[model samples]
Target: MDATTMADAILAALGGAGNVRGVTHCATRVRVDPAESARVDVTALARIPGVLAAQVVGDRVQIVVGPGRVEAVSGAVRRGAGSATAPAHRGRLSARTVGVLVDVFTPLLPAFVAGGLLTALHNVLAGPGVFGDTAVIDTLTWLRGPVALVGLVGAAVFALLPVLLGFSAAGRFGGSPYLGAAMGAALVAAPGLTADSALPAIHLTPETGWVIAGVDVLAIDYQGTVVPIIAICFVLARLERFFARRTSGSARLLLVPLLTLLTTGLLAFLVLGPALRFLGDAAAQGMEWLYTGAGVLGGALVGAVYSPLVVTGLHQGLIAIELGLLSTGGSFIFPIAAAANVAQAAASLAVWLCARRGTRLRALAATATAPAALGIAEPAMFGVTLRLRVPFLIAVGATAVSAALLAAWRVEAVTLGAAGLLGFASIAPGSVGPFLACLAVSMLLSFGGTLAWARWRRRRGRPIDGEDPRRSGDETAILSPVAGRRVAVESLADQAFAASALGPTAAVAPESGLITAPVAGTVSAVAATAHAYGITTDGGTEVLVHIGIDTVRLNGDGFRPLVRAGDRVAAGDPLARADLDAIVAAELDPVVLTIVTEAGARTFAPIDGETRVVAGTPVLGPVGSPENI
Candidate 1:
């Protein structure tokens, strides 16, 4: 689906744009903080095309749309929801804090990825011993200038990272981005409060720098620091808002920037900067100590939980720590992430191999494997492995072993890149061999482990991938819920239903406004919007009767439920009444869908041919079964 349409469908599923409190996206998921979590229709979300998965972690609804598409869809959602301002703090303090951090750094990924690749290139071309005893730059003297230029361009982002953080943080915190950038520039600017200042007889150091109320303020460079800049920009945002509120007109514009900058800058140099810089440093050192001191155990722990962290949206917070580690020397986290990603890909591939040909599971696994191998593992993780249950566990176990091996070999990445097979390019040249070795082990172990499990299941007479364990009971026929002209499921405009992602389905263009029970059983569910209903048959068939496409947005305007949950109803009994004209007037399709959402032990064979039908007619039944005319 197009981004705009996807965004609209997501909003409608999320209870419309008015219900979205805040929205943001990471690499593969659009994280939405809803004004009312209870209002979110997870079923509808899962039915949206291109949505790999829809889940609720804490107070946020994370819709996984895979890697390449998340940014555009998220941008569309953000615009539609009007959530360009700072995300409202709605969940746990830690979750909200992480959301804010994600907002600040997500926009910088392109720069990080580009810089990382370039730096890796420079390492190959100029770093000693990368090519025999001498580097490519040394072997070819004429290439020196271009190689030097590459190194400079590659290092620029990290060198000026604080400034970038300043601009993003300030904008996120609701302040002028330019002023925040200026603050960042001041932190990295040389000759200002340094020991060897240009101004003669004016030197600064821990021992000789200006004393602030008996405390000596040390002059420190904040070039690649993360915490300090983020903290300072937040303060800057507050100061700007404070100044702007008290001043008016021309004076407001003039005084706000001037006063906010001076006040915040002083606070940064004397208090916030020094204090937060220490905190940032400690965090970096703590991570280093964990990896170095704890050795293999630490790496295993990180690798095992990396995918889970991604699931909960906590992994985005690790970017700051990764950046910190990069500044210090190298990041061990990236190598472990690479191993974990490769493991997932391998497990997905294993599942595809075990799955029956032409089955949905095999197709999904086949499509997800390549992307997972490319470092975008959400499709494999969410769409394939996690759904199967066992493959996800196998992948995690394999990742732990591989990460432990990497730690034993002291392998690390110098910069960020694809955290899968292509990650070798980003590994420190000397550590590249170990990284590749661990990655190979991860792939082999994950693939073998999953395939072994599938074989065990087959030996036990259990289904490997195509069979649903929930399937039970005998086959039954499903009655049409509306009197209308029959329509084929595959011919519908809604791709999710057409693809049978929600199970076997048939649609009808309604000839009447009255909707009826499709099965003789209890009313399982009644949508608050009155546009949909669910009925569980006596034989245990789960059926969903949807009145119209995108009719949830009507908010019960022209729909009324005649039955409530737990009410026993016979086939053809009134379930609801929908205004077909109202649905069409709202620019939505007025097709009624009768879906065998779950057909336990029975394959749904929708009636062939597009013919007019009446409510209560048998429209779907087991293969070769006579229609109940």
Candidate 2:
């Protein structure tokens, strides 16, 4: 489906637009905060075209739709869902904080990437080593102006970063973006506030200043500072809102902006800016201490958990810290991130190489590898490595070792860019060789380890997909729960059942009201609405028997349960009786669904090409079993 259709489908699966409290997107996922988490149909979401996976992480529902496609999909979702403000009591504080950081910086990636690449270009042309210590620009004197211009253009983004941050932060905080830019402009470009110039009335050192009204207003330059502008924007948002509420009519427009700017500017200069700059400095120093003091161990630790952090959506907060570190010349996070990205790509490539051709696993692995190598790892991580389990662990272990090597070599990135094989351009000129070396180590170990594991499994006559290799002698036959025409699970109207997200599934268009036990088992649960029953077979297969599509809304008006939790059941025993006429009159589908919620060690294969089946007849069983044949 296209982005618009996908957006509508996603909104519907999220219990419709009315159920959404907020929506946002990062590099590879569209995150939604639903009004009721219980209402989200994750199974239906997973079945949507282009969705890699659907998962609930804490209080938010994240739909992975890949990188480049996420922006369009999320924009459409946001428009369909209306407002983006989340309810205060809905999510944890830390999650909200991370969301804010992601919103403010994700839009600035293009600028960062362009400037970083140009900077690398400038380094190559103007710096030493092009001809035995003579720079390329020096040898070709005509290239001097162009080379200088490239360096100048490259430096502009970092030098005026605060303005861009301020504008983005203010919009995120629900204030005027232009005014926020004004605040940043004042900090960086306004006279007397910069280190280059001071107020004529006062004599102060460039590095130090006296206290004003008990607040020490430091004379530090805020050219590329991150924290100070963000903090100032937060206050600016609140101040603008406060003024907006108090003023009215003509006074509102004129006074709100004026008072908001004047008051916020004063506070920023005398308080928040000076104070938060220290915090930003301290955070940078702390990261440097971690990089330099703890050294290789610290890099290993970061690499090991970096992918896990991405899974949890906590990596968003790291972007702010990374920007802060950039103000201090370079960031260590980028190199480690690069190692982890390359490791995941290599592991996915191994899976693609080992998987049998024409299999779903091979197709997914093949599709995910290129993106992972280009610095987007979600596809490889979610679709291939994590699903197989061992490959993901192999990638993590490889990343840890490679990141340690990078740290040992003191590799760091001067700017933000793709954190994969192409990331060398973003690395500090002196560390590019080391970055590539460590990246090679990451690729070799992850690919070799995963390929070796696959070969070992093959040698033992086991499935490379990480499934059990048990013989068919241990098979179980799951009988049809009701007498009717057998229907393919994929043909069912309910996407949750059609996707078989619950597990291996079968559907029957019931000709009778009686619902029988599909297998001899113990009842695990009986829905309060009397429309569903959960049974665990003696061989340890979980089965869910849902009476009809959306029958729970009837509130047991046309249903009767013959079983309860903890009750033992025999194959062909009546489990429930549904009033088919009442269900038809209520405009609900009366198709009975039997799903293998959990197959455990057993593998389920449904019988195909059966137009009709009697109650108590085999509908699903293990592959190679008589029932399956």
lDDT of each: 0.75, 0.75
Compose the digit string of candidate 1's lDDT tens values, residues 1-629. Answer: 99989999999999999999887664345779999999999999989998877877668788877444766898789878978743232223543454466557656655654565565566667765445666678889999999899878867877787788789989988899999899988788643545565655666653555666544444455666666778899999989977876788999978999999999988988888777655544544554566778888977876787776654333545677889888988988889888988888999999999887766568768867865675766567656676655788899999989989998998888877667777776788789888889999999999999999988876754445434323222435677888889887788765555666566677889998999877666577665456777777657887888877656556667886766555546666678888889999998888998877667777787876449888867788776677522
Per-residue lDDT for 102-136 in model 2, tens only? 45765665565456556556666776543345778
Which whole-number lDDT from 0 to 100 does residue 526 have in model 2? 67
Off by over 4 Å in 2: 1-89, 92-95, 130-132, 190-218, 288-295, 299-400, 406-436, 442-629
User: How does residue 264 of candidate 2 score in lDDT?
Assistant: 96
Report each candidate's C-alpha RMSD, comma-separated, in the order given. 16.2, 16.2
In candidate 2, the residue pairs with backbone N, CA or C atoms under 3 Å apart (3 or more residues apart, or in different chains) clash, namely none
In model 1, what are the clashing residue pairs, if there are any?
none
